[model samples]
Target chain A: MRVSLRQAFAYKLDFIFTLILGLLVSLVMIFVWYAVYANSGVSSIGGLSLNAMYVYFFMVNALSFITYNAAVAQTMQEDVQTGAVSTAMARPIGYNTNLFLNSLSVAIVGGLTVTLPMLLIAIVLSHTAVSPAALGLLLIEVLLSFAITTCIGYVIGTLSIYFVNIWGIINLTGFVYYFLGGSLAPLSLFPKWLANILMLLPSQLMMYTPAATLLGIIPMDEIIREIAVGAVWLAALVLFTLLWLRRISRRVVAVGG
Target chain B: MGLKREIKFFITCQRYNWLSFLAYRMQAFVWLSLNALFILYGILTVTIIYGVSSGISGWSYYQMLFLIGTTGITVNAVWYLCNPNGLVRQLRSGKLDSTFLRPYSRLNIMLSASGNVDNSTTAISSLIMMAYAASKIGVDAAGMLLYAALMAAGISAFVLFVMALSVLAYLLIRGANFVNGVLNFMSSSSKYPLSIFGFAGQLIFTLLLPIGIASYYPAEFVLGRLSLSSAALVFVLALLVGAASYVLFHKFMKGYVGGGG
Candidate 1:
């Protein structure tokens, strides 16, 4: 964790830049959604009060800034492509563990320093409440979201071992995750049939569940169901990651050292 | 004679790019599939928004689709026409110095090198979608021609803007990060209806950023809400911006000290 903090500080510019990107997106969403509600002359739609909708996107923005794991996939892909993986593989610490640790540090440091501040500003600007109980649950969900996303990123990065360029697949999967996961818009706004299907998917637990919980949108009974489902998703990802690492180890070769 | 020679050179480079892309068929397929998937996802978002409300700010559901399609066309057209990614990579690697040494203009070399058949495919896909949307709205042939011309101008402006942004590579080695970040913001925000952003947002997008000219104004022109003169004014504005940015990029190139030659 300490080493990860140091690394994060070393790449402070990237952290700041990413934070700015998230801020811009959040601001744009605020303007767009506010107009949608105001122009349509509706006080509420799809169970989201105008105020609640603003809060939802604000929370979504902050959560997304932290939970996004494309950096993990990119880093691992580069390591393998550039043959830097061999150096890390030969070290006392396992490569997956190192990748996991580094990613965790990035998330923690970025979430704390950049995203959290944005979240605060968003909460203040949007005039949203922060429920103590929901905040507690959101914390756990964030950890699980990070783990699941990182695992998926690891799998995407592992593809670089076989293909010279896996950016296509990486980007494709990232888009699917974001669009289906409610990062683009609230899953609740989706058609009922589509929303029902999306709810069953684990992607919702990553972004929607956390934001919805934080906003007090989900009921207590459903919140427990979400956490249980997230647990199962995390466990499955962990098991897949372990098997993936073993396969990578067997086929790994040093390329351009 | 020089123009003919440049055309020949550009075609040769494009051919090589296409061949190289074909060499990695699987990767190319994945990229194309993903690009199409993203387009579909964008359509889904618009559909969901309209489903919840009657329409955004009096624009119909189909109009929004046309707007999205217009954005896709402009974004993908500029992307395929001149990727700018190649220039960024070359500039970083100092291979840009090689292009500079050639008799051809740097812009020509940069554009020639960045041609991608894959992005062209996506651009064509956007065009087909836009045509479908336009047809649903009962656009005439003349209107279609006008939209095409406006789109061409919009794409030119967008490419120039991207080039101007990349000029920072000459000053800061890691400048592409900032450029990419801003571009991502513009591209993401522009995919939705412009009116949904209110006055301040609309003003910034219309005047300062001018991303709306590429997609929004063109949609408005097709929908008959925007006058022909107004639409032409957008095209003229885009031309002016493109010209100014070209001059700025040339000035910035003078400050570039090669990374490696």
Candidate 2:
């Protein structure tokens, strides 16, 4: 936590810049939906009211800020490439644990410093009224979502130990995660059949499910099902990531001096 | 004679760049996939949104496709022609000192050095996509010609925007990182219709930053929604911005203290 806080402070400029960019993107999305709603002359589309749509995009933007941690991927790749992983392995704490903690710290700091402020503004400007219960549920789901995404990051970082130039892989992973993870547009906006399948993936927990819950668009039964599925996905990713890290750490040969 | 020599120099650089890229076929393939997947993602995002609603702002589905295609083409053209990656590297490694000693203008050397083919895949794919969208919208020959001309202007603006970012890199220690974040925002948000962004957003994008002029306005011109006089004004805006960026870059270069001690 201390290290993460230090790191956050260290890159405070980046955090602010990124926060501004995220807000701009959310603003753009809000205007797009507003224009669409006006043109369509409809109260709502895809079960999202105008306010709900604004709130959903806002939550997704905030959720994205917390979950998408590039530090873990870049640091892991660099450590492996420069053989710093070997030295770090000699320490008592495990490599994955270190990375997970660093990632979690960044999420908490970024979420608090950036997303929280943006979320408040979004809620205020959009006039979104969220019940305590829904807010609590959204918070819990965000935690789970954070864990799942961090696990994926760790997995990608571990892959770098094998492919020295995993830049392409990282870009591919990001594109897929953002596209399929409901950051680009809500999964609800996708074709029904496609959304159904994508809903089963880990990404559902990352942005869609939480954003939906926050907007109060999700039903009680569906929320329960999503939680169950998310828990299962989280467990699987955790196990797979741990095993992968253990196996790779045993075989890692640092290249750079 | 000098212009001919400059063209030859750029051609030689591209020849070597492609050769070296082909030597690592796997790497090239990876880059191609990355670009291709991004384009696919853009197309799909627009499709999904249009599938949900009528169209973004006042633009139709095919028109939205054209907008994204224009953005993709302009961005890739800038990436291929004036990639700042080499400049960032040169600045970081203090190699700009040696790079500046060459007979050619530093700007020319920087632009031509380490030519990028990574975005070529994107350029080609987006052109095909744009053509298909134009055909769907029944764009005429004159419309197509105007689109092409406007696109050239857009690319000029896009390159200037990147050059502005590059010049910023020479001014600050972490300017590259800052520029990257801003560029990501510019590229991503500009993929949508400019109407989606309100007055302030439009002003920033169209004038201060000028990405909208580079992509959205050109698209609007192609669609016949924007007048020729307005399009000409936009081209003039591009030229003015490009000239300003050139001056700023040269001014910053004068003060550049290399990263090395």
lDDT per residue as tens, model 1, B50-162: 77876567777777777778888777776776644456666767876777788887777878776556776666677777788888888999988898888778778878777
The digit string of per-residue lDDT tens for model 2 on A1-257 reads 77777865654565466567767777667877788888888998888888888887888888787766666887788787787888887789987678778777878877887778877887788777778988888777888878777778888888777676566666777677787888777788889999899988877877888888877777978887888888999899989988887777677776578
lDDT, each prediction: 0.76, 0.77
Clashing pairs in 1: none
Instruction: Provide the TM-score for each candidate, comma-separated.
Output: 0.92, 0.90
- Poorly placed runs, candidate 2 (over 4 Å): A1-15, B8-28, B82-93, B112-117, B169-174, B198-200
Question: Candidate 2, clashing residue pairs?
Answer: none
Model 2 scores a TM of: 0.90
How do the residues A195-231 of candidate 1 rate in per-residue lDDT, one tens digit apiece? 8888877788768998898777779788788788878
The sequence of per-residue lDDT tens digits that candidate 2 reaches over residues B1-261 is 887887787788788878877664654678887886667867887787778777666678888888778888877777787656466666767766676676667677777763468888887888888889998998999977887887787677667667767767646644354555566677777888766677888898887777887788888888999999998998888888878878877887777676655
Docking class of 1: medium
Candidate 1, which segments miss by more than 4 Å at Cα?
A1-18, B81-89, B114-118, B169-174
